[model samples]
Target: MRLDKFLKISRLIKRRTLVKEVAEQGRIEINGSVAKASSKVSAGDELTIRFGQKILTVKIQDLKEHVKKEDASSLYTVIKEENIQQPTRHE
Candidate 1:
């Protein structure tokens, strides 16, 4: 499945457009390589996503076109979450 679609279906990202934007900005990676919104995602693939001050790493556990809110968390397993400091501005 498409990376963007999977992210939404898995409830990782709340919106499809945001996924696209994140992927385009090179903040998403798959299997240690930078991936695009159209990148194909499958079971066992490692996904590292940057969300604001948090960096999340998850391994894809399953792929589904539709899932309930209660079951969405089952699609992927969180490997780690790290807090990152934002870059300071320089004039």
Candidate 2:
């Protein structure tokens, strides 16, 4: 499955266009390399997504064209999630 579609089906990003924009900006990485919207994804692939101040890492467990809201999270397993601390500004 395409990265963008997978993101949507998995309910990770909430939208396809947003995934495309995020991938284009290099905020997503697959297996330690930058990923594009069209990047192919499959089981066992590791995905690291940066969303604003939070970073999420997940391992793809399954890929489906469609899934129910209750089962969306079964697509991937979240390995880690951390907030990027912003440096305090000194006036």
Candidate 3:
């Protein structure tokens, strides 16, 4: 599935548009490489997300086109989450 779709359906970002914006800003990465909104994602892929003051890492456990609200969390596993004074971005 698409990175944006997975993020929204997994309840990670809540909206596809937001995912696109975030990805465009270099706030999203896949398997250690920068990812675009239309990037393709598969099970077992690792995602590194940079938020305002925090960074989140999650492993893609499964990809589902449609999932119940309660099962959204099943899509990915949270590997790490950290708060920082400044998020390092090459750009």
Candidate 4:
């Protein structure tokens, strides 16, 4: 499946357009490299998404064209999630 579609179908990004924008802007990475919206993804691939100050890392477990809200979490496994610490400014 396409990276953008996978993100939306998995309920990670909430919208397909947002997923595309994020992929285009280089906020999403797959298997340690920056990936585009059209990148092909499959089972066992690692995905990292940088959203604001939080970074979410998940491993793709399964891919589906559509998934219900209650079953969304089954699509991937959260490997790690960390909040990026901002450096304090000194005036």
TM per candidate comes to: 0.92, 0.97, 0.92, 0.96
Query: What tens digits encode model 3's per-residue C-alpha lDDT throughout 1-91?
Result: 9999999999999999999999999999999999999999999999999988889999999999999999999999999999977656997
Error of 3 at 23 (Å): 0.4
Q: Output the number of the TM-score-best candidate.
A: 2
> Stretches of candidate 3 above 4 Å error?
86-91
Q: Predict model 3's lDDT versus the native.
A: 0.96
* lDDT assessment of candidate 1: 0.96
Q: Once model 1 is optimally superposed onto the true structure by TM-score, how far is the C-alpha of residue 8 displaced, in angstroms? A: 0.2
| Every model: Cα RMSD to truth | 2.2, 0.6, 4.6, 0.7
lDDT of each: 0.96, 0.97, 0.96, 0.94
Total backbone clashes of candidate 2, pairs 3 or more residues apart or in separate chains = 0
For residues 1-91, what per-residue lDDT tens digits would candidate 1 score against the true structure? 9999999999899899999999999999999999999999999999999998999999999999999999999999999999998789999
Which candidate, 2 or 4, would have the higher lDDT against the true structure? 2
True-structure lDDT of candidate 2: 0.97
- With candidate 4 superimposed using the best TM-score fit, by how many Å does residue 50's alpha carbon deviate from the native? 0.3
Query: What's the distance in Å from true for residue 90, model 4?
Result: 2.2
Q: What's the candidate order when arranged by decreasing lDDT?
A: 2, 3, 1, 4
lDDT of 4: 0.94
